[model samples]
Structures are given as C-alpha cells and as structure tokens.
Target: MVAPPPIIVLAFFCGTSIARSASPGPARPAKPAPIAADARHKQLTFRNRPRVVRSGRMRRMNMSTSQPGTEIGYTWPIRVYYEDTDAGGIVFYANYLKFFERARTEWLRACGVDQHRLAEENDAIFIVRSTAVDYRAPARLDDIVKIISRIERLGRASVDFVQEAWREGTLLATGSVRIGCVDRATLRPAAIPPSVLAALRHGPGTSESAD
Candidate 1:
C-alpha cells in the first residue's frame, strides 16, 4: 500500500473532532403562572381536592361534605396538579383560598344562584364580609384535596358557611365564611333576593346542578 501524504497526516490533528463528543445546550425550565383564589372564596377562604364520602353527597377530596338531604349544602371534588403548587412543590397557602372558592361557587351553582345574572337583574352581588381560615396540614403540589361547604346560616342579606379542606382523609384547612348581598353600584348592603333565598333553603336538585 502507498504511504499516506505527510502534509495531510499532519493537518488531521488540528481538524474538527468526532460528532459523538459534542455537548448539548442546557435545558430551560417552564415559567409558572400567577396564583389567585377561586371565585367562591372571593367572599370566603376555601379550596377543593379529592375525597370519597360514603353518603355520596359529594365531599372535597380532602374535605368533609354534606350528607344526603342537608338543606342548602353541597360538596365538590378537586384534584391538585403541578400548576396548583409553588416552588417547593407544595400547594401554596393562597391556593387553598382558591380551592375553597371553587367548592363554594359550585355549591352556589347547586343552589341555583347565578351571581352574574343576579348582579345584572337585581343590581346586587355577594361580597365576602369576613373569612377565618386555619391551616391544619401542609398540602403538596400533587396532593388531592377535598373542599366541603355547608350553609351554617342564611340571613335576609347574608349567608354564613363552614368550609373545610382535606387531604388523604385528613383535615388540611378549615374556615368560616360570611358573605353579604351588596348593591353592584354602591357596594352597600342589600337584601338577598327572595328567589335566591328560596333556592338556598332547598339543596341542589337531583345533585345535578352546579354553581
């Protein structure tokens, strides 16, 4: 065999190396979205997750729900995803409020209370008068939570609720919520509508309605 040229042999050392040795660029992480409480908790502190209740009255995944035939009460299940958490991979404190709101909103829907329509026709909307929440246990990013909502009291112009959050059959958080009817324009106290009040007096029909 003929010997390789000396010049070509020398240039090989300075040429590009094998493609197998190349390095890939680092990967970028996705940005997270801003967190906000759910619409129901706008007037109260609350959240939702998963749970199984024997009564089939519907309970928050992590919360206590109404048993069958409790007047003007309802429960909804919710599952937590990564989007519901913070940097530590746990549900953020504020997020629990969102959860609570969701359950209550659905409860209201169960009550046949249309907030938007009520505001438009009656010129009134409910506002959170007060909310007291206690964090019992920390919930993780993917932890399923149940939110339970019940009407503790219903006045001419306001409703009081006992709301709770649960995870793995344990209480995660609890709160008492008070919401009052207010005039849309003045934001002043207003009496709850008779129709809405009647719906509140009766629990959702056939467990089919939702807020």
Candidate 2:
C-alpha cells in the first residue's frame, strides 16, 4: 500500500480518539428527582394506610394490633368528605366526635344492640351524657380515618367508652364518652336492659368489671 501522509495518519488517529472520548460509554442512568418533603410525607402516609375490607354490613379496616398501650377493639373506618372538612380542607374538630359516635354505634350494632330496635322494643335509647376529647393532629379531606372504640367502664345505666381517631399510624384525637341509657320518651336515665347489659359485658375488649 502507498504510504499515507504522516499528518493525515495523525489526524485520523486524533479524530478516532476524540470520537471515542466524546461517545458516551454506557450512558449513566439519570438520577431520579429528589422527592419533596411534603410529597414524601404523603407517599409514606398512603403506603402506611390501613388495609380495609368491605362486608355486607359495613367496611372494616385492620389496624396495628401491636400498638403498645392501645387496646385492641372494634374499629370503624370513615372516609373524610368535603362536608366533614372545614375551609382549611382539614377535618373539623367537632367532626371527630361524629366519627367516634359512628364507631361506637357500629360496635353496638355488632353486639346485636340496634338503637332503633331497642328504642321501639325495649323503650330504651342511648344518649351521650359527657365527652372529653384531646386533639393531637388534623385529618384532611380524602383521608381514611379509623376510629377505635373500646369500653372502659360499664355501669348499671351508663357505659364509658375510650375512642380514638387515627390516620395511618398517627393518632389524631382521643376521646372519652359516657353514654347513658334513657327512656326514649322521657329522655331520663333508665336501667340498661338485661340484653343490652349482657351485650356490653361481652363487647370486644371489655371486662365484666368496670375499668
């Protein structure tokens, strides 16, 4: 072969070296964008959301039975709606009471105590005599709120319940409510019927003796 020009050969070698250096060698994958703090918080909340099961009567969600100091009791799941929220888009403080009420009502229903039937057949009804609630955090719209209701005490004509509102694993509020049995017509305190008393005694996480 005819000898190539030294300059041409040098230029060709230089060009090949430059092309090799410039050509990407197995392009490094792009690093994912750093998740924002709020986004990360939301993702974590969604991931830790309780598992819910839908049945014929109502929806039930399984919560951490392992939470120390928390009594394993009947749980009711509530979905926060726009009406349950305030202008701030968070659940109104008073709405937690409603959530607790629903949970307690469901617990009673599970125990076979239907308030309406009790009122009609037994001439008895349950009325909230007093309630104390401590707000720890706020729940927002579209959040699933789990209300855990446990009987703390049982009286001849009254029952005290310790109810808690939780989102994921965070406790939003805690409440103690005293419910009194009353005559439907007079709204005066009445002795809890034998059937109702039996139901309360055998209720989930309840003891025969008042706590």
Candidate 3:
C-alpha cells in the first residue's frame, strides 16, 4: 500500500485521540442551583431533626417569655372593635381593663378551672379585689393586642396577677390585679379550693413554685 500522506496520518491520530478522550462513561446529573442546594440542605436537616409540635398554650407561653418587657405568662389576643374605641379613634382607656379582665378569665380557663363551674359545684367565686393600671401607649381601633397575665402572688384567699397589654411589640398598658376567692352564697372570704389551687399552680407557663 502507498504510504499515507503525512497530513492524513496526523488527522487520523488526532481523531483517534479525541474519540478516546470523549468516550462516554457514567453519566452525572446536573448540579443543583445555589438556592436549590440550600433548600435541599434545609429539607434534609429538617428531616433529620426531631419534630416538635407545640400546643397553642405552649406557643403563647414561648412567645410571651421571648420578648422584652414580657413576663412568663398566659397570653390572649384581643381585637379592638369600633365600640371599644373612643371618639378620638383610639382604644378607650377603660377598655384596657376589660381586655385585662378577659385575658385573666381566659387564663383561668386555660388552667382548667371554669369559674361558673367552680361557683356552682364548689360554691366558690372569684372577685377582683384591687387593680392598679398604668397606660403607656394608645392602641388604635382595629389593633390586635396581646394580653399577658402572670401570677405575682398567691395568697390564702387571693391571687395577684401582673397583666400587660402589648400591641405590635409595644407595651400599651400594664396592670396589677388581685383576685379574691369568696363563697358564692355567703360572699365571705374563702380559701381557694385545693383542686383550683393545684390547677393554678400547674397552669401553662407557670412554675410549680409560682405559689
């Protein structure tokens, strides 16, 4: 056979090298985008971690304690209705007391103590003995305020609570209220029932030594 031309030999060698170098092996999927990579990492991390589902009461407790100027307590949300506002378009000052009252009631309910039931079954009733309130800021109409109620002192026949009203992280009002236990029929001072006392001491966001 005639010797191949030098140019043809060079071309053949180059083609063979390229074919060998470009041969397909195992295929790799494309790399993920940066965001996708981060998301995937988060997903894996979440899967590997223990999942904790907190109850509503626990969530409120955590939220109340995590913020500045907030005490560990039971929190309740209240919406400002038009009727709750004054002609100046701000929440009426007295309405904050109402808000505090509602929160305290809810707190007691959360403690598994029903006031009506307590009165009917145990002949026990709770009455507000005293209240001292300080208004810090004004809450406008339609504002949703969170009321935090914490036990300050547990007396033999009375319980004092420190209540605060917060709007969007701003403390609007703070009040100290004392609730006294009494006999529903006699209206005389009475000791808080053992069951109710136990419930209050073990209520959500409260420590055993709270009393």
Model 1 weakest 10-residue run by lDDT:
58-67
Q: What are the per-residue Cα lDDT tens digits for candidate 3 across 1-211?
A: 9999999999999999999999998889998667777888999998999887766632121112336555568889999999999999999999999999999888898999988899989999999887778888999978899888888667689887778888877889888788899999999999999999988888865644457
- Per-candidate Cα lDDT values, in order, are 0.72, 0.83, 0.83
TM-score of each prediction? 0.61, 0.65, 0.66
- Candidate 1 yields a Cα-based lDDT of 0.72
Off by over 4 Å in 2: 1-71, 207-211
The reply for model 1, stretches above 4 Å from the true place, is 1-73, 204-211
Candidate 1: Cα lDDT at 201? 68
The sequence of per-residue lDDT tens digits that candidate 1 reaches over residues 86-134 is 8988788888778888888898888778999999999999888877688
Clashing pairs in 2: none
True lDDT of residue 113, candidate 1: 85
